[model samples]
Target: MQDTGSTVPRRQLGRYLLDWRTRAGLTLVTAAELLDISHSSLHRLEHGQTGRIKIGQVEAACELYGVPEELAAAFTGLARQSNGKSWWHEFGDLIPRDFDVYVGLESAAVGIATFQPELIPGLFQTGDYVRALNRAAFPNASEELQDAWVQLKLRRQHRVTRKHRPASVSAVIGEAALRRINGSPKVMAVQLRKLADMSTLPNVELRVLPFRAGFPTGLWVGPCVILDFGITPAGSPVEPPVVFIEGSTVGNLYLEKPHDVERYHRTYDRIRQRSLDAVSSRNLLRQVAKEYLA
Candidate 1:
């Protein structure tokens, strides 16, 4: 997983600049004037929409905001990192625009909380499961694009599978997801075993929302992945926690607003309370796998 969200560095760098501007109590217009840049340009930079960012621009903005020396250093470093290349560029037209953002965040996140209501979440899905799902969803896609899509997903799994500094992922899967199998019976059987195996990894915690638990009132009724970055040196979040709402028609929606993040967090907590614990969840998965094997 590449740290560059959306195949560029601007998003995270822009976020840092936006934070600095807010901390300096400067509105977009005022900040633009202070930086001697156009208001639109400044806004784009803050939102990470710029494809080309000069290192000096980031440095100047950080200095103007009177950020501490170390924090300014952090900003400059991010600018450099964001400017670098990654594997996402190779896929070209195969990837979705907004989805790139989700991948980038997934790469950088230190803690992840995901709730899957229908199917296995992408990160945990096996290659065969992915092939089946992609084939069904994009029936007209080119062979090259299909292969690229699977590669993209497998690459993204690095967040959880990376041997060193693996991100802590707490996945709450609905029993319906486990039952409504993807791929063939054999493929699904393997996937179930994969889940049972992955759940035992130290950094991955798996729970199951059984059919018996039903649904909660506030649950927005879709799969969502919440990404949380660890704290920075100054005891603030390096990046604010983000909630990714899976979308089919509208692309992926990333919710960074405090309210949206809070709502999802609460819903996840409530649903988690109703779900089976890790041991029981794994047992259920293995039991389900037995049915398929039998």
Candidate 2:
């Protein structure tokens, strides 16, 4: 059960170090030499892979990279926050570093754009839907463990309904997601109804991509969540929108490069364009839910 808290701050810290080094035209070897540290250590520092960072090393980097006092102090601030603990640390072993980072970032995101091809999004999943999914997916696991997972899923939904400025959510779901029979028809019916209900919230938008639109090329990898953290604070200027790809065989992945973020944004726009409007999507959900109920 190892929880390294949110990786965002540390990753941000690493990113600044890298940016300053690049701006100063200092290579890994050059920066490491200036700081009297190994090139590998400098590389790791830039990637936020180190669990413990010596402040003296960072100070040396600030001097060599010619980082401004303000930016340097901000970097140090991120360094400290990166080491903060996770509130969900009780489920530490159950979470992967990448997924944990996504959760941490999601908690702080101002808005999220989600795309799903074959199943309900976690934020909107019902307890029964979650339990059934776990039961079918993890047949060997004890029911108690699966129940704990269901509770975890439920807790994650608080972000959408919290009183203190909930994240604005827009989900473009493929028709397959509506049609996929996860649990019993009853369970799915309940799930779809819940989705329609949630869609009415001012902060949530829902759409469905019918089969008529056809899937786009290079967009079928898997479901993804694109998170936007709003304006960059004075302290953190390099914080960019992130694209989180769900892994089929492993855990989640983060794509933060400009190109990666742009690619996902384009994909999201294209998919959204092809999907039914919010009202139409809600009608479709209700229609299908009636079929299940009937």
Off by over 4 Å in 2: 1-99, 216-221, 232-238
**Residues 102-172 of candidate 1: C-alpha lDDT, one tens digit per residue:** 56567778999999988898889898899999999889999998899899988888778889999999999
Candidate 1 structure lDDT: 0.79
Q: What Cα-based lDDT does every candidate model obtain?
A: 0.79, 0.79
Model 1 regions more than 4 Å off: 1-10, 13-99, 218-220
Counted clashes in each candidate structure: 0, 0
What shift in Å separates residue 89 of candidate 1 from its native position after superposition? 18
Show the lowest summed lDDT stretch of 10 residues, model 1: 87-96
